[model samples]
Target: MSAQLTAPQTPAAAPAAEPAGRRPRRGTFGLASKALVNGLLAISAVYTLAPLAWLLIASSKNRKDLFSTSPYSVGEFHLLRNLSDLFGYDDGIYLRWLGNTVLYTVGGAFLTTVISVACGYAFDKYVFKGKEKLFGLVLVGILVPSTVLSLPLYLLASRTGLVNTYWAVLIPSLVNPFGVYLARVFSAGYVPGEVLEAARMDGCGEVRTFARVSLPMLAPGFVTIFLFSFTAAWNNFYSSLMMLNDQNLYPVNLGLYAWSQNTHQQPELYSLVIVGSLVAVVPLIVAFLCLQRFWRSGLTSGAVK
Candidate 1:
């Protein structure tokens, strides 16, 4: 009896083979499920890409071809000519609008990133009265829709005589509460209290420590916030419409919208609007490609340590 107990009781009879037919059926079911998922994704991708495909084809056509030709078919290969006409129209106002968009997006995103980083760093590294309350207020602002702020912002801009000016747009973009929130998160993850304490022990002043020690670690987060702010300010339309009346100050998005409205009056503007849209997309694509690395690095930086 003792020897049999010590021998592992014949290995427990190997618990029956889970029915060989059931194994094949389970594998088939899994494959069918995978195929179904792949099919759904393909359909969704086609739906999303269909309009974009048409835009590319339509931008290459003249007005006559745009209305007449199949969406995917080529028509006279007028992309270069359409671009020329787009730029030459209204004394090259499209180029002017493009410049304006760059100004707004770049300037606003930069300032917003700086402000956010500073605010977040302070929140994470320092303890002060009402810190949580102030952060809670920032979170609340995030829940408030941007559109709701437009009317109030417009009213304020009108009162200050900033309406129809760059300040009207730039001022609002600088007050990004969401950036502040992200900055705090990044600070908590990327910058350690121990590191900050060491900097303090080294006789470094607060600003000097943050500038030299904390900032480099926070670079990825800054890029992420800047991308968000840039996209928001670049695509901004409702606020710009509410604040600006002058065509000269209109960003590329609003300029495109204006051109769209006039398409019925001048059929050629239809092609210009389509081509101009494609042009507007180029900078964003380039920015995304260049900055995507920073974003990916940021997502994983705080996870490990």
Candidate 2:
């Protein structure tokens, strides 16, 4: 009886109830924050896409529909008509301009990539006199805007009778300080000393090792340099305008500028110019999409190491 009474004195444990409304409050707050963030992101995405949307819509309109119809409206689809007109204009001069642009971009970019890769690799790998000073000079070149040098380049080209020629544009593009800097960074990260030493042990010459082993590893860097140089050359207006007086030698940028000026008098040319602008951007988009993997991989390769 005493044992039973002692046992009965133990207080009953408190009932374990669900947390009073705290969970619901927290859940509501989280949901509200997420909704706000999503809303903002949606708005930002729309804003970013708006210009491309307008360009796509505008390119589909003819001369009359461009001004009269709604800017965003899907008018009588005239994209094919516009393309035909663009190609047919001035005995297919637009096509010629397109070719010239491709040549300038691809040619200059290729040469620039080669030069940058060689210079950067040499600077990083070879021990030479005044290396720091030379690299410092290159950094100075990077700090100096290309526009500032345009006049000097023009004078030099004029003296050498290289002005008013494709070489005027191409040769200048071949010397990209930024590309060289990027190449140096890439070489330091990707081109390992151990691999180089192993290649040397295997009786590989420097040239052979670079061509076979190092160049393949530097593909990502090369692609990036190529794209940069290509875009720079393609969009180069001032240099091309200053260097090229002949309409036949004009790249798309200069050609478009010429068209833009005439658009004041020939209102119909306005539609063509818009359509041409839209067309011009396509190559750049294609190039980026195609080489995006290399660009991304190149950037992230050294993040861990």
Candidate 3:
């Protein structure tokens, strides 16, 4: 009678499974690791910014205040006066040096970008004689630092009587092997072979296909190469110094170096040099700010293909 009256017991419910792709809740260890990473990142940011901060402060101060004051502290803001001296000194020759730098950087960067895009596209799309070998040579060039080539470049420039001329700096910069490599990587990712085939089927010339179809796709590559060449040409002190002796043809980097060298005899030039250095940084800052979108977008350009 007792057994017959007994009822069946129910089973306990199972725990629910987490949804697919959802990350598990971070534990204390995970949180600690995240905090550690963030702290490191903050330290890096401060490390990178310290020089620029010093530059700003140094630029604002007179020479008397620069050495005596704390690096982060503000001083006698002779910024306006320093700028006037910077521009007005030596019949405004600093402006000429600035112009020289702009010309070299812009002209060289543009040419380098175009040539790099062309070469990279060729390496990626067209199968030809010694293609891989040629590309390998380019990779080799990347491994070889620019300083290694500076002497050879100077010798070649001398042979052609291009020394002390704008062409000396501009020519070598235009042949950026790194740019070519980047272009190839970009072409592989950005410019689809199908698009090129379609363009060809529609009777588009190779040059036309590249110009109308591939060039637009390679926008990120172009900006990256342009910035590289610009920086190379702008800070090209050793090559410029090796090739150029005439002050008239000197880039701002060399010009500033010359001023810095003379500072022992002329202590007042320190303010001018500091001000010039600050001003020199502005164009690069502006360029990066303007093209930063392209640079960021290009990061994923070669990531896929």
Candidate 4:
């Protein structure tokens, strides 16, 4: 056999090694993105907490320290004294305001949650004429700022003789368009259609089905809505400002605002405002801390099923 005398083939040129400087580094972009996000979050946290920090520090100081020291400085800790004066001021009116705030927030939030969740359930489950149209209207209401509706609400309250009464605030608070929208979303996500069908097959009426099966399943959503409504009603300053002239009906926010306005005339009120504001924040913090588990579950439940 003829020897294979083929010319020795040249080795295939190795792929030119990419320059080390030009090689893509794994995770460089990812690390850069993470750093950027962390930086932005830190900035946002600082911005949000700075005023709160000032308030906290200032609340501990007397008026002299407030003016004499830096805003962030710690002065003579008089927190208990401040609380005593705050609750004792003006015939213990702060207590009354605190009570009113609780009533408005708790009662109104409960009612609002029920109504909103019911409406949302109806929107999701029931097929009625003009259903989408009505929901669209609700969405329109959401687009309309609450401030814009205050005038109309005030006029309606005046005509009905509700102005300056608890009803004026409570009634309007019960009609949260956004809450209704949220309820509908939650209903759609949390409730399965088959469950309703099974309930109906078991001879359960619509209301009975809702109350027993549907509502129980929607607990996370319920707590979420309650928290939102509570926060909104708790901080309901503008509505109270517009609707109420009676100081007796004031919520904590409105009362604190009033104290802030009077601080220029009564220098002692500065301490009151600081301490009152501090007190007002406690409820919201407590609410979140207590109910955060439910809120978290509500947010994540519908995502999967």
Candidate 5:
């Protein structure tokens, strides 16, 4: 009788131990799923980074090594030599082009952001006659391609004796309809009515309230608009090409295009052009990396509601 009771208790204990063993299998399956997801992300990251890595490596090599050496391997590192040769190749024209790009980007971006923000804020806060009609017009403007308008704009600039000048490029770039639309969206989300009401009740003037209260709230939107305008101006090729006849006024994009055209005739310039392209991309990367935190926060703040 004692042996029978002991045997029954052992069978019950075995069933309990079996569940404990099965728990590890379930944990392992979960870990495997996580591992698979992580691996895929790693692969995607590598694919995205590969081109940038190649650009860096290629830029380090000179003309001879660039063509002959392995694309992945670092060949006799001559980045400084390449940069010096790049700057001195044509009476330091590259430096001038860089300066022109900076000026265009900074000037165009500043004016565009200010104008867009003002337009957007007014559209959001003010209730005036023809508001919807005007906004509809703005939407139509957004749909109109910049390329199509380029010819008309060029003609107008020529008539005004502004063609081939910086103003011609700067003025058109400042009137970005898309930027205005983005600004309106950002203003609607960021600038709360309560805050504006509070400011007004405190005896603040409209302009004063906007500068102190609204502008601070719209900083992230301003940064976003600035970056968009800056990138567009920096990369603008057709407008710059059409507007300017002088080499001194050329931005880096047009300058690079000129070099690329000559590459077929003077193949040595091929390496220089490649190297220059690699160098040209660095500022954009740096700007994005620096401003990404603010951008992320701003986007998320608007999205959370």
Candidate 6:
């Protein structure tokens, strides 16, 4: 017996470990995607803001500098002079236009928001016959071009003797089918049935429940609707043109349009129009800045819930 010639068995070699530095990088793909998205957004932003930048600069330049100088170049700072001229032109009629715009936008937007939100809340929370049918009609109304209704609206206003009156503009502004649709969506998301039921169970009436309980929760929706309606009313050119013949009753946009139309005959009015447009843009900017948070939240209401 040759002392049990059992050879020692060697251990199997271990698999080679991959290098840490050579690991596949996920950050590369992520960074590239982010860069692409950011580039597109930056381009879009420049496209959108360029006109506004032009407007701001042009608003500051005197008439000679407006056309003679480069568009993006700084000219004589005539913003104050231009504003003075704008206010003094035509016996300060620009103020009248601004006042009219404020009146129409604030009054009409408030009423429209109220009506639309109420209708939407009812549509969302209440049970009734023909509810879906009525909402479908609203959707149909949204599809109809606003311009198409202009003739009929004019005729109706004529029949009722509302033509060339504030009512003609304000009345039409109050009927916002899109606002109603948005309100219904917001109501569905922001409001819960249980809270409404609890309010009712506490002997709260329908109107009271809405006013005290639900309306508070619907603040974001209301502000959103109001902003939309306000912008529409502020920029309401065609309607104001058809509805108002009195220069004093014209909103800022329509008044500026009138000035622009007369620019061929009165070259100085070009400056006035430019300056007035800048003034007209201020309120809208302020409103958006103030309500931006609520507006953003309102927009995302139904997106999550």
Each candidate structure's count of clashing pairs: 0, 0, 0, 0, 0, 0
Stretches of candidate 1 above 4 Å error?
Answer: 1-26, 298-305
Candidate 4 per-residue C-alpha lDDT over 236-295 given as tens digits, one digit per residue, 9 for 90 to 100:
889999999999989999998888888778999999999999999999999999998976
lDDT (C-alpha, whole model) for all candidates: 0.89, 0.88, 0.88, 0.90, 0.86, 0.90
Better candidate by lDDT, 1 or 3: 1
The digit string of per-residue lDDT tens for model 5 on 38-134 reads 9999999999999889988998898888889888999898888888888898899988988988889987889999999999999999999999999
Clashing pairs in 3: none
Root-mean-square deviation of candidate 1: 5.1
Off by over 4 Å in 3: 1-26, 296-305
Better of 3 and 5 by TM-score: 3
Using TM-score as the yardstick, the better of models 2 and 6 is 6
Which structure among the candidates has the greatest lDDT? 4
State every prediction's TM-score relative to the real structure. Answer: 0.88, 0.85, 0.88, 0.88, 0.84, 0.89
Across 43-120, the per-residue lDDT of candidate 2 in tens digits comes to: 999998898899999999988889898889988999999999999999999999999999899888999899999999
Model 3, TM vs. native: 0.88
Question: Please, what are the lDDT tens digits per residue for candidate 6 over residues 1-305?
Answer: 46767889999999898887896567988999999999999999999999889999999999999999999999889999999999998899999888889889999999999999999999999999999999999999999988889889999999999998889988998999999999999899888888888888889899998887888788899999999999988888888888889898899999899889998899999889988988898899999999889864643333222
Off by over 4 Å in 5: 1-40, 296-305
Please state the error at residue 219 of candidate 2 in Å: 1.2
Give the clashing residue pairs of candidate 1, or none: none
Of 5 and 6, the candidate ahead on TM-score is: 6
Model 4 sits at a Cα RMSD from the real structure of: 6.2
Can you give the lDDT of residue 8 in candidate 6? 94
